[model samples]
Target: MAKWTTENPAFVDTWFSLFRLGQTKKQFNAADTIKMSELTFFNPLSSKDNLKIEATLIADTIDKVFSSWGAKLENSISRNTAINDMIQILLDEDKTIKDLAEKNDENYFFTNEIKLENES
Candidate 1:
């Protein structure tokens, strides 16, 4: 799984809480709190959209953090390429498995259980 090391747990918790409240209460304003938390976390350094300025700052902060850890964005992209390649291979294999299941009258299993079994 891809990891984001600089993610703030408290911020995430609050974001989720706001999202859940918005869903349960059907209040559109609850999204404002979530958006604010996102802006606080992803403040970009430069952005054309004033609404996204905070997010730009946060992105700049994350870039700096990654640089300090010796993992720049380019290196992260390279790593992600490898991960995507692996995912594509797995998806192809899953298609093959589904074909076999269809042929055998077992139907195609698309659940986590099947994926975990295939992995093992």
Candidate 2:
């Protein structure tokens, strides 16, 4: 099994720390800002199934870590864009859809009338 081992785990931790700072009116550091920006640009692709699974697991891990602090893993685009470009790419690239459905429960249609709601 693949694992997520970052060069700087503190960088990932600092990104989550921003949510707390935002809630408490504390100032976020410059490094935190840069790390968050770097994380936003990740777009991995692979031909091997194992690599794809590993990548999806990593993305899911990041999404979960941020979500614990009330931050959502949204696309790097304005909400008013013509298409949800990042989400489409994620789906096409075999990234897990469960995270997206969990975050956007209101938008997921399970049946003609019943939308699958996330209990989270």
Clashes of each: 12, 0
Structural RMSD, model 2: 14.7
- Tens-digit per-residue lDDT, 20-120, candidate 1: 43322323323322223232222344343542443233333433333353432232344344333323322231222122112211211223334556899
Best by lDDT: 2
Predictions in order: lDDT: 0.30, 0.33
Model 2 collision count: 0
**lDDT by residue (tens digit), candidate 2, 69-91:** 45432344333221242234333
TM-score of 2: 0.27
- Given candidate 1, what's the lDDT at residue 99? 25
Measured on C-alpha atoms, candidate 1 has an lDDT of 0.30
